[model samples]
Target: MDDADRIQAASKFLLQSPPGEINDVLNDVRNIISDDDSLQAGVLPALREYNLAQFITADVPGHQHQSIVSDAARVPSGSSDEDDEQSQDRYWDPRSRTSFRFDHLTLETSDPEHVEPDSESEPFRVALENAALAYLASHYHDGVVSVFSTPGSASRFTIQIVANKYNPNNFWSGRWRSEYVVDTGAKQVTGRILLNVHYYEQGNVQLSSTHSLALALPPAIAPGGGAAAATKVLALVEAEEGRYQASLNDTYAEMGEKTFKGLRRALPMTRSKLDWDKVLGYKLGAELTNSKAGFSAA
Candidate 1:
């Protein structure tokens, strides 16, 4: 089409009429983009539809437009949050004996966890739970720990983990769940466990506390490249186990079937070190720990 015809076409769909000069069209183009190229290829596409709609609905025609973003700008500006999000979905898959899968990582407020609870003073407690779960899933690297979070009420949130359930090793067994109450105004979070798992075979074990504890978000660790991330999976798991065993006085969970009351009464805490060889048997192709009460070969 001729320059005159081009101008006419642009004028009609603008949802209003504008001048019919090529220079007029040039001005419209300038309005849509900044004078400089601040955006790269990936970000430009998402902006396309939003930009077109915005241009057509301009309050004043032919005004120089600056880049505009809709609600989805949660990540770094111009970096597709979706790209980061999509990649994380492929995290450790439970079905995969080889690696772990952490799912549905999001920074956007549109996510359910980010939703404002009915009360302004205390929004849904899950608001920060996501951050905790994401940290666990992203940094822990071990597919053994399943990290999940849920919003129960305006002020209630739950973050839980079931570790070493699938792996064929005794490094970690059973589950640990933590619940949090969020007070948006005071910026406080506290939690306790509602359901605890024990290996009746090994004796009832208390992995986490039933009493309320302050919400503690683990500090951010280096998010390395693929290989490094993979390496961390086991390292984090081992470190956690070391902390667990050390906390328990370098003993393993009691073995053999027993009552919950029996477990609490005086069941012996097995005086054993975390046989690194047995606990990490899966990763090392080492010997598995014999099925002892709650701890079993995955």
Candidate 2:
């Protein structure tokens, strides 16, 4: 097909093609165009249309228009001096903003020891649980994690974590434990920590909880060339994983030290004659002993 015909075909494909069909059209046009400049020019309009479709279908309404205007302003122009000035002014114009709010973490544990019958233990346990939740949320925000979750009444969030295969074994291996301290007497404790996945969604405000863990992974990574698009996807994915790892790590650390210390401190004077050095020494020794065993086996 001639350049004009090819452009028209591409435009039509962009307008009516199902997502699965776009790749076929792209491939066909790519094969037909011989010149580098013509091929790039031919694909530009179609790409813009695809981006517009994505923006419109995004969570925020009218995002497509905002994206288009932002993109137009950034296109460096070698036209007249007046045009360059106009482009600069347009780039600075305020566009519609999309707001996001992250909710507190929802705890789900599998440890029966952490579940308590005493009313006094409830608040402390809840506080520890919520603290873990908040830590995870903050981590997600910082890591630029991507998360996808179901949207119906029963939907839950699932976050993805990517790790390099070459990283140290310690990078991927760690036990997470979260516990609530009750009275120092009887050595009683209640709480559970299960090795489970986490999911997060943007713009979701519901505070309810669910029992199931369902996760759907995105089929491809590095799918877009646009800087903004790439950043958003990476951020979402990293944030989700960061939240999970932080929650798990923080909980485990708190349970080992603060929770144990609080319980020890709450004991009766006679029993409170605790040996801090012995307690910490024994804990650290146990961890080292375990690590040695694993290393030896390896």
Candidate 3:
């Protein structure tokens, strides 16, 4: 078929259909594209093109993570500018999406006999990290969580939960994080969890929402307490984490769905839908012809 016919056919196939009929339309489009070598070569790539980096640029809510350690010290260091660029490029690739953050979380305890106040020997950092991980894992089983240790003599660290979704017409990315700093002398832990969701789609649309909670809790274990005391603290932390997780999930779900509908509602309009293949084909052919004419004049 000629360029005009090709554009018309493609436009008809590309018309946005009702959500329930989307899968059937997609199968038909694929079959059509496969039958026409020119359509497969010229139009399929344009429809599939999505620049995730341009859309996933929003930072997580209420926090910025700056690590002093080099890539060699941290497993899969993603803090540097170069690393972020690489991640952005590979956002759609499944291999780059895997995370093993829970492996770094381990319970730490002080030597019961020599439990001196504010002693450097206590493993408060690891214990705190473990507590945060436990909370996240129970709630967001499919999420990718990462743990980062802060530099200097401060007894603190951060844990982040990252999740993303990519499809034919939608892109979504979210990050929720908590930073826990422990006081050995006081046997207390203080920090906050921040949750945010951001999504973008084909119609030049964007939506986002954020929620945060401040936390102050007893340490996972008392300085001099042995395994018995540690068990009690762990149970308490679990219950507390459950409460916070529920609150964050409820708020995020409500906001995310509201914005999701706001953008999708813009897609289909009017009483009758135009045949996108025909519409896009006419436009594409006209543009192509104009471009050739301009180039010849130049």
Candidate 4:
């Protein structure tokens, strides 16, 4: 069958088969596809191209979990020619460097204040914080909780939970309280959440970060955060790609130099040590003799 026919047949088989039976059918189909030279060369590339385009153009959300803070240092203007030249090249100069820091970023739904409270317990408020934390955890790959106070701090982060923020039936509003703490030892700034509540009724709930790093919490609970994790991932991906490209270039250059040296050495009698044909024949005979002796020993 043609490549398209084969693919269609495979797909149909998969659809009809039970999940447990899929592996056997898939194996058979793969064998069939690999046997076809035309399918291997043409159809596979076409399928991959289509898949990649779909992946790249997928309409994912715009928000990210982490963002890199770009810090630009102002270069002082100098009067002398040498100083002016240095000033102009500040960014590129080995001594001059720009520092980039990553912050845990988050995004939340805009506050909705008009919905009436269903009860003093504020079920919607609780639910919203949980949902937001879950979303943040899944998207950003970070452990988050609906915290009322900073883990070790006496101060609480304020959350404004308005009623009917997400749904008409729901009544809760949330605001985030964020704090920046500088760790002198690690030389990093930690953005901590003080308290996250729906703000329907202001009472403090104790919160901690003792859960797994992938904990799902409410976005309202982890207020003032969105996109920080995703931004960090993107930055890492970019840095890794750059490193890989440099290593690849270096490897290619090394390979090329080795190949050139080998070619140079392969040329006819530039050095008078030995003749190539005679040397190769002697080596082959010695290898054959050794092989026969080894076999005889076995």
Best by lDDT: 3
Off by over 4 Å in 2: 20-24, 56-298
Better-scoring candidate (TM-score), 1 or 2? 1
Off by over 4 Å in 4: 1-224, 263-298
lDDT of 2: 0.35
* Tens-digit lDDT string for candidate 1 (1-298): 5544443444443322121122333346444444324322323332333232221111111222111111111112344566554332221111111121111111111111122333421222223323444555764443222222222333222233322232214322333332343332233445443223333335533343344455322232222122333233334433444454464453333333343446564533675445555656554443333444237543
**For each candidate, what TM-score against the reference?**
0.25, 0.22, 0.36, 0.21
Weakest ten-residue segment in model 1 by summed lDDT: 103-112
Better of 2 and 3 by TM-score: 3
The 10-residue segment of model 4 with minimum total lDDT is 91-100
Rank by lDDT, descending? 3, 2, 4, 1
Q: Please give, for residues 1-298, the per-residue lDDT of candidate 3 as tens digits.
A: 6664764566455443221232445457655555565654444322322111111122222223211111212233355674342232221111121121111001111111111222342344345435545655676644444334444444443444443443434554454443344433455555445444444455333333344444444554553444444334445545655788787689669868886668666445675666876998979989999999999999
Worst 10 residues of 3 by lDDT: 102-111
In candidate 3, which residue ranges exceed 4 Å CA deviation? Answer: 1-122, 126-137, 143-169, 204-212, 223-241, 248-298
Model 2 residue 28 CA deviation in Å: 2.7
- Residue 101 lDDT (model 4): 16
> What is the Cα-based lDDT of residue 263 in candidate 4?
62
Report the lDDT tens digits of candidate 2 across residue range 1-298. 6787867675666554332234545666665665657765665555544533322111223333211222321223446775343333222111222221111011111111111122433333233323333444654332111222212211122222211111122222211222221111222222222232221233212111112222222333221222332333334434544565577578779878887677665666676556776998979999999999999999
User: Could you report the Cα RMSD, in angstroms, for every candidate shown?
Assistant: 25.4, 25.4, 19.1, 26.8
Q: Report residue 253 deviation for candidate 3 (angstroms).
A: 7.7
